[model samples]
Target: MELVSLIIMVLGLAALVGIYVISRVSRQHSPQKRDENIPVLRDADGNELSSVCDDVAARDGKRPSANARDMSDVMMSNVSGKSKGVHQPIADAVALPPQLVLFIAADIEAGFSGEEVLRALDNAGLSFGDMDIFHRFVLSAQGETSLFSVANGVKPWTLVPEELVMQTTPGLSMILNLPSQIDDGDAINDFLLTAERLTADLNGILKDHNQQPITPALRAGLLAMAA
Candidate 1:
């Protein structure tokens, strides 16, 4: 009876060891667990943006190739034209309130030349105006309605053409005041379109209020604000 008990104990120990070995092997062959908290970027249509290599490069603090950056420009270009049909007039004497702002930053290490930004602004139809910044205006039966404004990304936020002739800035800031006299949807769309155009022309990066690169999720949130 004692011998039988010993044999049974040995068999149980061997079974336990085998189970442990199997678990170790399975774990070694299993895929690594992904971090669930990482934000998944998607466009308006739920299409994913950026590639694994781009993510990896971003994580490593390496600048992505021009092709990768151009992809974002293409995406912006496709949606930038939607604001053309929104032509509601805004009150000329409306008071300015707190504003929602977006940034177009130069991706190059040396930043953007003032001349380049000036030309881009001209092409986008933003004229230097009140407060030393650039303003976009829409003509209507009432008169000219300001759609949005652009300022220098640097401090003072003004674009004095004389100073700009010799100045080099990191980028430009686009500002839109909410709850204004203009149609919110139209204003936002026009603002985005202008920003997109400037970004493409300058080969810059479009950033959110926080100055981080604009993600698809962020883009959706911006569009939703008009709703």
Candidate 2:
């Protein structure tokens, strides 16, 4: 009887140890939880428009701009067909130019050097053109159509190399107006790729329209808009 009791106790202890080991391993491999306090921008239908990551917020030390909030409201109204008294079809809604905006910002302590900014812009295939800003063009059936445009973040936004030399800017704003002559999806893809390249070249943070760090979720949402 004593021997049997000892065997039962050992088996129970082994089971508990096995369970503990499994739990620890599972936790170690589990995905990290997102911070609940991070702000999320959603449309009228509760579809997430964009979100600010905690790490980005900490790094930027800034909140989303009022313009971003206003844009979100405008998008929601467009999506819900509330822009006009009558319900508008999604196809018709997409016909209107939906502006996709992104930002490349330098570190808070220092602004981008004029030489570096000009070099980055040139490398990204932007040419100084209309509005005294830089424009990215793509060839389509209609000939060269504007894919996107880049402007200095500072007042009187222009990207002329000579003008850039006069003043350092904290960032640049890249805007893509959709429903151009080219395919929207292709245009969006090119726009994002160019923005990413410019961001890398300038060593700047790539932020969404809301001026928040671009996360995978935000990227997907932006792509969906083009679709």
Cα lDDT of model 1 by residue, 1-227, tens digit: 99999999999999999999999999876544432112333445555432221212332243323213233343343334234433232223122223555778877655778999999999998888777878898775578865667877765667889999887777777766454447766777777778889999999988855467889855754554443
**What is residue 123's positional error in candidate 2, in angstroms?**
0.9
What lDDT does candidate 1 reach at residue 153? 70
- How high is each candidate's TM-score? 0.54, 0.57
* Highest lDDT model number: 2
Question: Which residue runs of candidate 1 sit more than 4 Å off their true CA positions?
Answer: 1-98, 140-142
Model 1 residue 7 distance off true place after TM-score fit, in angstroms: 99
Which parts of model 2 have CA positions greater than 4 angstroms off?
1-97, 225-227
Cα lDDT over the full model 2? 0.64
lDDT of 1: 0.63
State residue 213's C-alpha deviation in candidate 2, in Å. 1.0
